[model samples]
Every structure is written in C-alpha cells, then in structure tokens.
Target chain A: MNITSVPFLFLFLPICLLFYYLIPNKKSLVLQNVFLLLVSLFFYAWGEPIRIFYLCILIVVNWLLGCFVDGKKGTKLGKWIVFIAVLINVGSLFVFKYLDFTLENIGFILGQELPLLGFTLPLGLSFFCFQAISYVVDIYRGKVKSTKNLLNASLYLSIFFKMTQGPIVQYNQFESQLISRKTTWTGFCDGFWRFAIGLAKKMLIASNIGYVVTDIFATDTASLPVVSAWLGCFAYMIQIFFDFAGYSDMAIGLGKMFGFEIPENFNYPYISTSVTGYWQRWHITLGAWFRDYMFYPLTLGPAIRMRKFLAKKKVNKNVAKFIQNLFVTGCIWFTTGIWHGATWNYVVWGLINGAFIIWELYKKPLKNKKLDSALGWLYTIAVAFFTKAIVCTPDMGSAFSYFGSMFGLNGNSLVSDTTLFYFREYWIFIVIGTLACFPIYTKIKEKLVNNSNNSKKVKTILYGIETVALLIVFIISIAYSFKNGYTAFIYQKF
Target chain B: MQEKIKEILGELLIGVDLSSKTLADDGYIDSLIVVNLVSELDLEFDIEIPFDALVNENFNSVEAIEALVKSLQK
Candidate 1:
C-alpha cells in the first residue's frame, strides 16, 4: 500500500504503533525485533503478497551467505562466497527487472519473437537486492561484521520504512541501533515534525506540480511548443527531486520514530554548480555505495593494476591515471543508469551525466565559487533539463524529439497558447518549487544560530514561529491527502 | 617513512595540496583520489593493500599509512 494513503495514514500506522509500543522489555530484546519483523512483513505483503515470499527467501539466503563470507574471511572461500552471493543477488535482479527488456531486444535483432515470461516485479526488489549484496560484500571486505542473529538480519533487509524507496542505508549504520536504541519524547517530536514536512512536500508541492508534468509528458512532442517543452522539462526536474526526496524524508523520519537514524539523501543538490557536486549531494547513500563497492574495486582492480604496470614502463602517471578514471567512471555511471531502470534510455542518460561530470572534473573542478554564481550555475541546470528528458521519457526516439521541440527544431512553435495556458496554471507553483530547491530557510536558520548579535528573546520568538508553522504544514498536508488521493513516488518504480 | 608516503600522496592527488592535517581529517580524499592513492602506494611499496585495509584508520594520515605499510612489509 502507498505510505501516504488513507488506510496507511490513519488505520495501519496507528495499529502498528499500538502493537509496537505494547511489547514489553525482555531478554535479548528479541521480542520487540520479532514484532517489528512480523509487522514489516505484513506491510510488504499488503501490496504484493507473492513477491513478499521472494523477499523473505532473499533475506534468509543472504543472511546465511553473509555468515559464510564472514567465517572464511581470510581465505579463497571468502572471495568465492562474495562472488556467488553477488551473482545470486544480481542474477535475481536481472531475471525480474531486465529479462523482458533483454528478450524484446533479442526479438528485434533475430526477427523472431521469443516466448516472454513476463514476471511481476516485487515491491522494493532492487532496493532489498542491493541491500543483500551490499551486506555480503561489506562482510567479505571486512567493512562490517555479520550480524549474529537472523531475525536482526531480517529486520535490516526488510524494514518497511526504507524498503519502498531507500536512502539505501548501509549495514553498519543501523547495526548498533538494532541491538539497542531509545524512543525518547524529543526524538518522537522531531520525527513527527520531519514526517509532517515530507508529507507537506509530497501532498502540497510534488502532487500539484506532478499533475502538470504528467500531462506535459503525455502530450505529443512532434508539434509541442518550445516554451511548453522547456516548461515541462523544468517542472519534471523539480517534481522528481521533491517526490523522491519527500519519500526519503518520511522514511528517515519513520526511522527516527523507531530510534533508528537513517542518513539524509539530498543536500540541496540543485544548488550544486558542478555535476560531480550534484552526485555527492543527490541520493548520497547510492553514490557512496557505488564509490565504495563498485568504483573503488573497479578502479583498483586489473584495469588500474595494468595502468600501474604501464606506468612502471615509464608511462606518464597523469595520463595513465586519467585514462583509468575515465574507464572506471564510465562503468559506475552505466551501472547507476541500469540500476534506475531496464531501458536503454536510462543507460544513455547515465552515460550523458557521466560524460558531463568527467568533463567538469577534468577541465575545471568547480572550485571558483565567484564564477559559478554568474553563468556556470545556469549551464548546470540546462544540462540537467536536457538530461532529465532522457530520464523521464518512455523511449529514446520520443526523448530526442522532445529535445528537438525544446531547441525549436522539427518545425515546432516557439510559443503557443498551450505554453501560456500552462504558465497561467503553474507559475506560482513553479516559483515555489524552484525556490525550494535552494536552502533559503536553512540558510536563514544557520545565520540566526551563528550570528553573535542574536538574543534569547529573538531565539524564543523564532522557535515559537517555527513550531506553529510546522503544525500548520502538518494539518494542511493531512487535509490535502483526504481531499486528493495518494501519489506514488517516481523513484519507487525504479 | 611517513614523509615519503606523504610526498607520494601529495604528488598523486590533484586539486588542493594535502598534508598531515588534511590526511588526518580525510576531508579531501574523494573516491577519485583514493583509487589513485591505492595504486601509487601499491606500486611504490610493491605490497598490495587488501580491500579491508581501506579503512579510515589506515588512510587517515601519513603516520597511519606508514604504520600500515610497515606491518604489511613484515
């Protein structure tokens, strides 16, 4: 079920919370964890009952494999264990997520239709699979110890809050907290406040703008107006950020309510002037996961080892380093792309983003803040606008045609009534959405905190206003949800 | 020994000049730099650092790196 739905918001969460708090303290705290595991399983089974079985099987197998890897840490068995675990996890993902796409491509090439066994994808299959692989790999690499208990492992792999669209919290981040953590009044208040903010973001902001973007994306692009194309593209760009980040906020807030601290995913990524900076800020957990597991290993693997060997033969260190980085980064982005979806367009989007980031990193490192504020920032957003079309479109051909319309190619109108109509409908929201991308409120709060001239009276007044504002946002979000229905997050489909 | 590794890392990673203080904080060691550092150190010392050895404690400073290398050599 959608987390924001009426059933989930009013009935399911209340019942779950009631059961959770009713559990008493006991030996090993296993009782509380078991209650959570059962509740989480029920949560997963709500949307996809059959697929929930697959998730449980994955948890059990990965937990066993993790222990095996840990047991044989210093031997060849450890390496083989990791290889097998990765293969099983990734192979399942391929079968479920990519088999249909792969078969379609093969049919196109061979001029014969293959029997397509189209399987229904499980909810959070990619996320839980990635978590499983990361857990095994982290154990293999000695990054974290294997959790001794299976129930704890199950909870880690299948927790409902983060299961849907993850900030992709790593193994170690929650391991200790799983053992023991507190649920204090302050933490509960903060968690509720955070959840309210995310609810506002999704209910009030993302859903409204999402309607316009969806309409725009659905329109035929052959005769679409240039201004309308640009407007839709920019709207989609903002819509996606808020939609996914909003989910992340609620997940983390839920984590806080349960005395687990989930990491922040977005750091006002739109403010970043560089593509590299953008990656660092956006979906931070995903980036770090790739950096540690994918990028580092690939870079330090035979590719760089061979580069190092060549450098020993009097090759230029700089040249060899640059070539290796290019290769490794290409692979990282390609993986990142496919991880998002099964389509070729996602892959191309990844390559495009990868190309821009590499160019920025090598040609200029975005160190000059003064120059960045002038025109460089606009260039970054422009690149994202074009790239976002590839990401949001159904196929490559439609995406390029949309780009053509955006650039006033293919006999598309430069301006039209449709464009004006959209502007009339969406201007206020567009302004609010655009401004929300920057941390204006956060900056002012930081200023008040750091500035020495601020007094106790000022602090108290500001805090009071903030509390009242939060309550208003919370009430409004709930009201909106009741008036309208739930809107599924864009990233959760990935 | 620490000075030697420091010199190599400073030469290898581009952008800001790195020193003991910067290394200790590890504030500047992005993924790009870490890969290059591992390769260069592996080449210079002719000893492989395992994946587990990529921990913050080992890579946090010149001193930590020197100690790790010394132990690996033994």
Candidate 2:
C-alpha cells in the first residue's frame, strides 16, 4: 500500500504501532521476531498476495543456507558452499529483475521470437535478495556471527521498513540495534513527527510534481513547446528527489517508531558542488555499500601496484592517481547505474554520472568561490536532473530527443507561452518539493521543540499549532488522493 | 610536502589556496575535495588509501594527510 493512503494512514499504522508497543515485556526474541515477520509478510502480501509464498520460501531457504554457510566458515569447502549460495541468491534476483530484458536481447540477436515468460516481479525482490546475500557473505567472512534463531534471521531478511526500498542494512548493524533498543515516549513522539513530515513531503510535494511531470511527459515531444519540456524536466528533477527521499524518510521514521535505527538514506545532495559529492549525499547507504563491497575489491590490484610505485619514485602523482581513480570510479558508476535497473536508460544514466566524475577528475581545477558556490551548484543540479531524464525515459533515442528539446534545438517553439501554464500549475509544488529534500526545516523545528528555555506554556502552544498545521497538511494530501489512483512508489517496481 | 598538497588542492578545488587555508578545518578539503585530492595523491605519491582512510586520518588535516602520505610513500 502507498504510505499516503488513508487506509494505511489511519488504520494500518495506528493498529500496528499499538500492537507492537503493547507486546508485554515477557515475549522472547523469538516471539517479537515472529510478530515482526508476520507483520512484514502481511504488509508485502497485502499488495501482492501471490508473490508472498515464493518470497517466504526464498526467505526460509536463504536463512537455512546462511546458517549452513556460517557453520562452514574457514574451510575451503565452506567457502565454495557460501560462494554457491551467494550466486544462487543474486542469480534469482537477476532472473526476476532482468529476465525479460535478457530474453528480448537474445531474441533480437537470434532472429527468433521466443515466447516471453512475462514473469510478474515480486515486490522488493532485488533489495531483499541483496540483503540475504550480504548476510551470508558477512557470515562467511566472519564479520558477523550467524544467528541460530531462524525467526531473527527471517525478521532481518523481511522487515517492512526496508523490504520495499532499502538503506540495505548490514545484518549485524540491524540486529545489534534490534536487540538493545528501547521504546520510549520521547522516541515515539520523535518518530511520529518524522513520519508526519515525510508524509507531507510525499503527498503534498511529490504527488503534485508527479502530476505535472506525468502530464508533460505524456504529451508528444513534437507538440510540447520547448519551454514546457524544460519546465517538465525541471519538475521531474524535483519530483524524483522528493519522492525517493520522502520514501526514505518515511522508512527511517517507521524504523524509529519500531525502536530500530535504520541508516539515513540521504543528505542534502542538491547542494553538492561535484558529481562525486552528489554520490556521497544521494542514496548514501547504497554508495557506501558499493564502495565497500564492489569498488574497493575490484581496484585492489591496481591500487596496490600504484601504492608500491608511489613508494619507489617521486614521479608525477596527479596523472597516475587520476588514472587509478578514473578506472575505479568508472567501474563504480557503471555498475551503480546498471544496479538501478536493467534498462539502457539506467546504463546511460550511470555512464553519464561516471563521465562527469571522470571529467572533473582530469579537467582544469575550479577555484573561483563565487562561481564555485552558485554556478557549481547549478551545473551539478543541471547535470543530475538532465541525466535523470535518462533514468525516467524508457529508451536512449527518446531521452536524447527530449534533451535536444531542452535546448530548443528541435525546432519547437523556443518560448512556449503556455510554459507559464505549467509554472502556474506546478510552481508551488516545485518550490515545496525542492525544499523538502533538505533537512533545514526539520533542524529548525527540532531547535524550536527542544529549546529548554522555552516556557512549558509556550511549548504547548507551539506544539498545538504545529500539530494543527500537520493535520491540515495530512488532510490536503488525503483530499488530493481522493482525486487519483494510488501512485505506486517508484522503487517498489525495482 | 605541504607545498605539494597546496598545489594539488589548488588544482583540484580550483580557486582556494591551500597555503592560506588552515587544513585544520574540516572544510579545508571537504569530502569531494578530499576524494579528488586523494585520487591525485594516490597517483602522485603512488600510495593506495583504503576507502576508510578517507574517514580516518587521511583527510583530517594537512598534517594528518601528509603524515599518511609520507608513511605510504615508505
């Protein structure tokens, strides 16, 4: 269910929170995990019932394999067994997420029409499968102890907070917090505030931006005025940030309310001055995951050789270093972009980011502070949003064509008078959506709410006002929902 | 070594004189600045820094980074 849906907002969350908190202190980890497992399963099954059985079977088999692999750690045979298990999990993910694209490519090459299996992808299959593989891999590496308790393992694999999209928590990072965290009144209030803010971000900002962007993209490129195309692209840029970031905020907030501390998924990525900076801030956990797991390992050979070379000679460091970074960074971005989806668009998106990073790597140094601050930001945002057009479009030709339209090079009306038509329709949303991705407002609110010098009376009055404002925001979001079908979270399809 | 770092930062970050800025400040070479600097440093100095080093001593300050670079040079 969409996080903004009235049924989810009013009924499911409240009831879940109540029961989760009300569990008596006597329940074992087994029971608590089982409770979480059941809730998570129900949450997934509510949207896609037929997929639930397969999802459960995957969870159980993977959990057992993880245990088996962990038990075998340190032996050569154990290493082989774990490797095979890891391959199985990732292979399943690849099959589910990429099968159709793979088959179509094969069909194109062979000049034979293979019947499409038309497999319905299970929700969050990519994320959960990765989580499973990481858990086993970590165990095999002795980075974490294998949990004997199957239910605990199951909960780690299937938690609702990350099941849809993820910060891709490491098994130990999650379980460590899970075992020790306490539910408190203050914590609950904090979580509730976070949830409400995230809900507002999604419903008020993302939805409105989605409405206009969807509308503009729906129009044929030839008919779309240049100004309208640019405006639509701009709106899409803001829409995606808020939509994905909002989902992350809600996921983190939900994790908090459950007394779990999921990783923060974003920083203020838009303000970054470099493509490298953008990756650090955007989908931070994912970047870190790739850096730790993929980039470092792949570059180890060259990196080691480079280190030894540097030790021996006072040779030119910049050129050698740039080459090393370019290679590693190129692979990181290439894999990162493809990791988002199986499409050529995602591949291009990744390469574009990779290219930009590589360009910055070897280009003349940028030192002008005034230009660096404003122009740098504009350039980074433009590059990101422009390439995001690739991420949003289905194919390369359409994206390049739309990108051409952005420059008014496609012979469309350079200044579509109706450009203001979209501005009038989506400007408020664009403004709010852009601002919502930053933490400044939330930080400001925290200072107001937590200032010790404020009188209790003043605090109560401010809290009351804030609550009322949030309620209204919630209502407006609901009212908008009353207008359309539930817009699925984009990441859910992955 | 300090001069080398200055040249590198000046080249990578573009506008700032690393000679003037106190490398003591975290902003001296922010994360992106650090990544660029290290990529250059790795090539120039031929020292491979593990990713975690960026979080630890490598980017903390000029002295810290210099010390790490010198050690790696060995």
A-chain TM-score per prediction? 0.95, 0.89
Tell me the tens digit of each residue's lDDT in model 2 across A1-494.
66777777778888888777678634554456668789888888888788889888887887777787775666897778677776887788777877888888899899997777787677888788778877887777667778787777788888887887887887757767656567677777777777777777777788778878887787766567778777777887787777778788888888888878888888889888777778778888777677555665555545546644764676565665665566677777777776788888888788888888777655664466677667767888889778866876678888877877877778877765567767876777877776765677667767776775765765797779888898888677677666654777767776
Estimate, for each residue in A333-401, the C-alpha lDDT of model 1 and write its tens digit.
999999999999999999888888667655643576587554667777777878888887889999989
Once superposed on the true structure, which residue ranges of model 2 sit more than 4 Å away at CA?
A26-29, A69-82, A110-114, A301-323, A363-365, A414-421, A437-465, A482-485, B1-74
TM-score of each: 0.93, 0.84
RMSD of 2: 4.4
User: Residue A493 lDDT in model 1?
Assistant: 80
Q: Whose DockQ is greatest here?
A: 1
Best by TM-score: 1
Q: On a 0 to 100 scale, what is the lDDT of residue A232 in model 2?
A: 78
TM-score of 2: 0.84
